[model samples]
Target: MEYICSVCTGAYILGATGLLDGKKATTHHLALKVLQEKYPEIQVISDNKVVHDGNIITSGGVSSGINMSLYLVEQILGKTAADRTAKTIEFVH
Candidate 1:
């Protein structure tokens, strides 16, 4: 269920939706600690490249959105598809 893409502080919205409760999630590094303190129900993760917990996929920064997208493609469409997508898009990572 990694189809969801919640990036940076945008996870705040998802958190408000109650979708992040009890789920390991992440957001901008600057907001990581506060988001956790603000929502103890959410197992906020930080200092990672990306985070995938159940249906939610969160990126820690703007650039991490690409990594998160690649991760989602791999989860939903297979690694080969993800690789192809990345190659086709000239993704360096």
Candidate 2:
């Protein structure tokens, strides 16, 4: 299963489930300290928009989520398809 962190706080859920153990992750700046303090087993990254460790992908915040969505479309489909979808939605990469 692919686990994506919507915000820093969500990392706790993933970490609690053991999916984020020994993996690099990040969260919203506001939650970084608390997340790291709570999940010491997980490596917390700072000043990052996104962090992908294995099948788990974590985004910093809402905008990062949108970027991740577009990136996933490109990865699962292709650049052409992603571009087409982006154009349709009027979202530039």
Candidate 3:
């Protein structure tokens, strides 16, 4: 999920609901600290543009959202399909 939004409230809500609990996730660099504090159960990983914890996938900023989508497409479809979609969106992954 893309956690870039107003303040860190949206991200905090999602994480607090256990969606991100016991999962490795990330958010916009600016919100990392808040994320960690709000969701202590979640392992707020940094140093990555994208972090996937099983069914729960978390992304940093808007650009990272694009990357995460490409990752999901590649997982669901084949690499060829993912490549095509990325190309259509002018994104490289």
Please, what is the TM-score per model? 0.88, 0.81, 0.82
Candidate 3 on 58-92: residue-level lDDT in tens?
77877787787787777778799999999998877
Model 2 stretches astray by more than 4 angstroms: 1-8
- Which candidate would rank higher by TM-score, 2 or 3? 3
Kindly give the stretch of ten consecutive residues in candidate 3 with the minimal lDDT sum.
1-10
> Mind giving the per-residue lDDT tens digits that candidate 2 earns over 11-93?
77898898888999988888888888998999999877778788788877767777767767776788998899889988877
Query: Model 1, residue 33: displacement in angstroms?
Result: 1.3
Give the top-scoring candidate (TM-score).
Answer: 1
lDDT string, candidate 1, 1-93, tens digits: 326768889989988889899999999999998899888899888777589887778899898899999888888889999999999999976
lDDT value, candidate 2, whole model: 0.79
C-alpha RMSD for every candidate: 1.5, 2.1, 4.3
Which residue pairs collide in model 1, if any? none
User: TM-score of predicted model 3?
Assistant: 0.82
Candidate rank order under TM-score: 1, 3, 2
Clashing pairs in 3: none
